[model samples]
Target: MTAPQQGSDAKSNDSSSFVTFSLAEETYAIDVLQVQEVLKVTEIAPVPGVPNYILGIINLRGDVVTVIDGRRRMGLPDQAPTDQSRIVIIDVDNQNVGILVDSVAEVVQIPSKSIDPAPAVGNDQSSRFILGVYSSSDGLTILISLEKLLSDEEWELVRNI
Candidate 1:
């Protein structure tokens, strides 16, 4: 959660830049400013006493970053890492954490007007984390809130680590 790239409210802007990524079979996005880096699937050192979503830790240069199994966090079925697998480093609160995504897609600029609330699609609980749906030339992209990626209790646990 680095202070510089705290996730902001996307609903308040006329236009927003999002870094899109793929998870499971769906496409998703987050504020571009919140993204610190995107890395390929790399070796992660496991941490004890953490939840299942935590894959492990990675030493980024000198900083130790906590890697999260984003699919698990979002309640999606787990799949083995492939060549397209990526670790998206996001800044939330004042710490930087890594979200393991299936693939890192292109960045997209979407107008706020084109974004709408998440629809009740088959009662998917993971949809709770989705902030809105952005309509683009390709299709609709689900926009997520990075700050809301982890719960308060989860944040506390990460802070302790």
Candidate 2:
């Protein structure tokens, strides 16, 4: 699987590239390989009846892509989008998905040995999505696995939208 390959690649290379972003004041990151692109806040056409985290859809070169609010997905209270807000397009389940973040931070190389397993303290819902925790110069950045971010049922809902 890609997750294991990603780990092995990190171990072999000594570091892995990650695209970092802010969500609810905490820094979080995802493997650079999964990132398609990053965009500024755009007008997202809201879809009815989907989960609250599913912000809506956007036209990306004629492709309708679902955008998810990272904060809402993490069970955090909603906040107003600011000038720094961004939409990070990533590949999930072989489909392109966008994750809205407070801001898109610079990509950085994190050492494989610096990554710690996800702590057991968080609630199950939150912990499941966390791949690991890396202590960086800025602070701790939680690495997320998009594949685990949603369940089969949830992916079905997103697919239907």
Candidate 3:
């Protein structure tokens, strides 16, 4: 795995940066700092008795990284990935895992003024994984909270498997 490159303005407090990606038909973004790298989908070794959403584990430059299928985690039906599928490597609570996305969009700068709190009811589970919503010219992009998305329990299970 490649080490994270320190931004030139590392000392600056920036809340507008985000790395966007696609899942099914929806576009989402997460704090760019939370992202470790972007990789191609690779072969994974299955671990029996684990949740279906947990695809399996893959060797990432000598590091065994667990892979999570975002669609399945969100209660969506399983579907084959297209040419655009990507593995978004993220560091959650110091554990590295790769989340399978339909495709990666782009890195965007979302000003604080453009972000709004997630709705309370309609998107319960999805909202739990979200930090905020950013409205852009293209459309709405859900900003994900990586630490909350992959809490300790989730990582512990992956680590044990």
Residue 7, candidate 2: alpha-carbon lDDT: 38
> lDDT per residue, candidate 3, 1-161, as tens digits?
23435773533433477999988788889889889999888787887878778999899888888888987765556778788999999987788888999999888777676689976743565667878888877988988888777774655666654
Error of 1 at 38 (Å): 0.8
In model 2, which regions exceed 4 Å deviation? 1-13
Can you write out model 2's per-residue Cα lDDT over 1-161, one digit (the tens) per residue?
13445435535657789999998888999999999999999999999888888989999999999998898888777898999999999987788989999999889888788899999867676788999999856789999988888664876767746
Residue range 1-161, candidate 1, lDDT tens digits: 22333565645455778999999888999999999999998999999888888999999999999999888888889999999999999988778899999999888878778889887773364776888898767877889887667765865777546
Q: Which 10-residue window in model 1 sums to the lowest lDDT?
A: 1-10
Candidate 1 lDDT (Cα, 0 to 1):
0.84
- C-alpha displacement of 64 in model 3, angstroms? 0.3
**Residue pairs in steric clash, candidate 1?**
1-92, 1-94, 1-95, 1-96, 2-94, 2-95
Against the correct fold, how does model 3 do in TM-score? Answer: 0.85
In order, candidate lDDTs are 0.84, 0.87, 0.80
- Total backbone clashes of candidate 2, pairs 3 or more residues apart or in separate chains: 0
Model 1 misplacement above 4 A: 1-13, 122-124
The global Cα lDDT (0 to 1) of model 2 is 0.87
Q: Which residue pairs does candidate 3 place in steric collision?
A: none
Kindly give the stretch of ten consecutive residues in candidate 2 with the minimal lDDT sum: 1-10
Name the lDDT of candidate 3. Answer: 0.80
